[model samples]
Target: MLFFLRMRWHWIVVTTCAFLAIAGTYLLTAEPTFVASTQLVIFPQVSGSEAQRAFAEDAFIEGQLEIARSSDVVGGTVAALDLVHDPEFVDQTPSLQDRAKNWLTGFSSGNGANEVQAQTEEERLHDWATAKLLNMTGIRRIGSSTIIEVSAAASTPQKAVDIADTLARQYIQKNIAMKANAARQYSDWLSTFISEQQRGLADTASALASFTSNPRDQFKLAELQSATDARRSLYENTLNQLTETKQRITYSMSDATIVSPATLPLSKARPRSTLIAAFAAAVGLGAGLALAMIRHASDRRLVRPHQIAETGGLPFVTLLATAKRTRNGHPPRFLAVGTGSSTTARPVIPGMAELSATVVGLRRKRRVVIGVVAVEPGGGASTIACELAVLSSVSGAKTLLIDAAAQKSSLSKAIAPQSSSGLADVLDNGELIETAALPLSPTLKFLPLGRVDTVSPAIRLSSRRTQLSFVELKKEFDSVFVDISAFSASPDANAIAPELDGVLVVASHGRTSIDDAMRVIETLRNVGAEILGAIINHAPKSMQP
Candidate 1:
């Protein structure tokens, strides 16, 4: 999270904009909906046995809740509201393809067929309205209670209220009708059973009368009398049940009652602007964090001195700030060692003295020849080389600044643009090296690349004569600072690398990638060049370590 906040906070605005766009679109396109709800309480009927009633109550309430959401209740509500004819409830406009198809059907069909089709279409519309109403309705039991909530949502407050009230009323009427129908069915079955019992009772009574009249067999007469009594008792019990069932059919009412009627809603329930905007903002924040992390993970620029050291397997020197340009547009100078005066036009970098000390400590002998090179161009290698040479000269060492980079000698142009003879003239044309060397200060001497044609310096620097020249120059000067071309641009640095005492690689912060720096390190190691350490140049103040 901190990484995102510190390194990639800009992503937040992008994500916020995206989320705002989506929310704005929804606000403009979506219709506001209002919701109204009605509550109903179910009471247990008193007709059944105690155990039967307890189980029945639970099952009954559950069944009713399901029925509230069922197609029957929805269809009844649709019929009561005449939703089939309402444009808001049913989409009357057909698509172009559908209109064309309908036209073709009417054109090909006879009048009778068209009438049948019209009836079918009406039925389809009715079914569609019922389905649509069901989608807009919600039914649920309120916790562990017999009460059920029926809610409806629509585009208008009145429509929502009407649908909710009408649905509850229809459910109540349907429940009453079901109970009455059940009682009537039981009464009808009882009536048929009573008729059968009456016939049986009459037959048994007739048999008993015959037995009693004959009086020949007492046991048979007793058996016939007992059978008649049993039949009469059974018929009386059935008659009592039939009377009770008939009374129930006449008196039974619906088990459910409306506890709260739906009222017109005061406000729309959905698409609340405040809630939607807050939610969109939250989503935007999360998306921004995700994008920031992704970008941070994929970034390859080296920003710290330790990162370059760890990546290239080299020791870290010191961080150097990007130099200010002089009036002539030359790179700035480093702080001179032990110089209390700050009269130089170029700004003094803070860590250049430390960098010079570290380089000086790496020297095994008094006269040290250090070549400065970079992994890629624009790494501030020339500026760093010039600064180090100045610092060494100010420290009272006889320092010679050598411009070995042939293609673009930034150091040569900055220090000695008008010099007719330089390292390039000496190496390519066998000119005297002493004539090319120019003195910048009593202790500091400068050697530029001088004028040359298309030939690359890598070829001239690779010669045995140039190698011997470096040996002789190292003896003449206490310290020789060679500014070489970037390793990626040419192999001139590598060609003269073996002749130098050590090489200091300069990497620009946020410009040189770890992969490129590591490649330069590997190439130098392959040539057996002694690597002293790497210096990070042109680092931002915030990035200094």
Candidate 2:
């Protein structure tokens, strides 16, 4: 959360895009609607036709509502009325008028693939707008009021009015025309049948009159009467069917009753940008947190030495290493004792001071020569060697800090500016080792890793030199500290460990793997070297304190 809050720009960009997308959709996609409305009340027109009229009215009202959605109504309205020309509302054909005419004539039916071509320009346009514009809404009304309601929407106010009025007029005209046609057709058919029946009756009467003279058969008279009664029943049924069809058509088309006309709506309906932006921010925050957790999981680097100390229950002596630079940038972040400083990079911070004091407490003697070695060369062995010498000499006793690592010239570079002779010259060439030791303070002296040309490194730490140096050291120095190269990677520890009181292996925090440390321990053990204890060198502040 803190990291997210700090990255304000991320939130801003996400929220802005959300806001624009939502706001733009609303502005571009939303349509404004205007509605117009009028009312109608239905009542009986004839004294004898009251029941029929009521039935017609009821059915007609339902028909009108349904017709509003039919192709005839929508097509006719679009063809007759002028509306905005939008791509979604137009046919793909070049001839707009023909398209409109065909639509109005009920030639096109909107369907799959017919989405653009199935409808004429006018029909397509009207259908495209029907859900948005003209809606019969309902044939609803106030209680006890026979008024039927109508509603619609369009780009222009006048168009809304035109649609409402035209729809009502067309519906009424269609209904009246249907009722008139049905009545006329029924009346014509009835007249023709009545005339034919009259002619037949005359002939039958004449025949009967002739038969009566001969005293006609009784079964024939009965059969004639039955036929006459059947005809009458058939006539009645036909009359009823014709009447009902007409009444239904009339009721459906009537304009004498209306509930309300549709009117224009003042506002467009759709998206809220702020709401979208808020939701986007929430999603972005979640994404950021997930990313942070993933990064945290992927980091595979060792950090504190306490991880081993707590788990292994081993005491670690913190050592400072002489800082060196490899070809890699800034030497790895793992062991940062002091940067690029070949001099004394080691220091007695509070924790180390207390730790060193404790280490002295566990020892049996004050003049212990602790050889500082590590699993690797850059693990602050020289730094530990220097600081340990400082700490020992700081007690007002004579002390000598020796650099045992020959491959690296960090000590030579550091002490050459002050000392004229070095340990290498003394070991291999029998050069005077006493005059060149640098006095950093009253009791402390630093020996440079000096020139070695005559003798091999293996022989320098041999029992012969050990005896020679110890014999010389007892005369002037109370304690000596040997800083060796990585004994685990090189063979120096095995060669020199026998000459020293004990070997102190220095492992860097966050750099040396546990396997590497164990190997160094094993190597010292294999070499018959005395393992005094392990030292954690060049550790970060948090790891120390």
Candidate 3:
């Protein structure tokens, strides 16, 4: 995970920066909203302890909260503040949807519709204001308590405070009005009932007086007096109820009281800039890491040392760091190993010395002929072979470096560019190795690919004559390094690999895939080739000495 993070650090930084830019843009362009809240304490106004106990229930408190958020309360507040004309409640400018609707309907359609349209427009404006107020308003009961919280959000702190306070006031007034209306209705009903009772009492009293005037009707007079007394008592009770109901209408109280008035907000309620930016950064970083991991999983190129064995199951010979280019944009051809400079290329590479020593150990059997091959072109096989031969020759052994890769004779071009005959001529025309080979030093000799118009190295490399030539070269030189073509480029390496004493597989760092290297190794092993080890050449600076 850490490796991938380092490899794709720039991508992560870029993604995070892009998210931060979006957050900054929103912070700069988004409008700010302020919230103000008021609290109301609800209770019963009736003159009884039972009413108060019932009012303490959560249901009663919830009902009061609903009333505070109702359309009636919100609309009353809008009318009280004349919010229909206020831009915060109802925008004076028409929206694009409104304009489009008007265009589709054709505004100049009929006459005699002005007054009706004006009335409808006024009603619509009021409804819009009420709806807008309701949307911005929030009413909730505070826990299990009798207190209700009413909050309103607006563009300005003062507007938010006004809306919240006005809505609370309207709710209180509506409650008082409802109580007053109930009391007035009761008073009217009691007055009419009392008037009917008074008439009945008068008739009973009249009947009682008439019966007393008759001397012989004593039983009828007593019965009439009893009936009249009961009627008088009922009339007095109805009159008292009327008086109390009238008083209640004059002094009606609200069920809820303002315990906490709305106050002006100090900060915006939305668009938390810092938190938004932090969240965006986190999301972007995660996304970048996911992308990096995906890319890393798909990539098969070998970069580190452990991957050589883990991927291809091949023995790690050594890693050769790429040499820095000289002033002319070319790598130094042949700097000695013990030189003071670390910038130039050396003939004695990091692992080549050990490889040369291993080859020299094999020289006890008369002669050692080793071939350096690659899975693909540009794996620096020729460079490794040349360096190996140079190191061997420097160690006082008679070394012969052969450029048998006829397709790409890089060694021949670099060393024996002037030579006209090489292994190609030696294999085709029976030319001797000593005649075709050029002298690089007293101990080292070079064999170029020479002309190949008449001979193909892939077909001739595995021939009987080529095997005899190898035998003669082995008898003559103590060490022979053959540079074969890439296995992907031609069949020459496969044909020539088994004939050599041992073959070194060359793979380029960061360029050669582990699968390709493994395939080459498997092919060589199947062809009865004597495998020595492997070399990772042209490694990046991080893997350098």
lDDT of 3 by residue, 246-335 (tens): 887999888999998999898999888779989999998988777767767887876666776655565545778664555643345533
When sorted by TM-score, best at the front, the candidate numbers are: 1, 3, 2
Q: What TM-score does each of the candidates earn?
A: 0.70, 0.49, 0.70
Model 1: residues >4 Å from true position, as ranges?
1-35, 47-52, 81-104, 155-159, 176-254, 263-351, 409-423, 426-448, 464-468, 508-515, 536-543
In candidate 1 the C-alpha lDDT for residue 462 amounts to 62
Q: What TM-score does candidate 1 reach? A: 0.70
Whose lDDT is greatest here?
A: 1
**Cα lDDT tens digits for candidate 2, 443-508:** 767777766675435346665743236446646787777777676556777778877777777777
Ordered by lDDT, highest first, the candidates read: 1, 3, 2
lDDT of each: 0.80, 0.59, 0.79
Q: Give the count of colliding residue pairs in each prediction.
A: 0, 28, 0
Cα RMSD (angstroms) for every candidate in the order listed: 7.0, 11.8, 5.9
Q: Could you give me the TM-score of model 3 versus the true structure?
A: 0.70
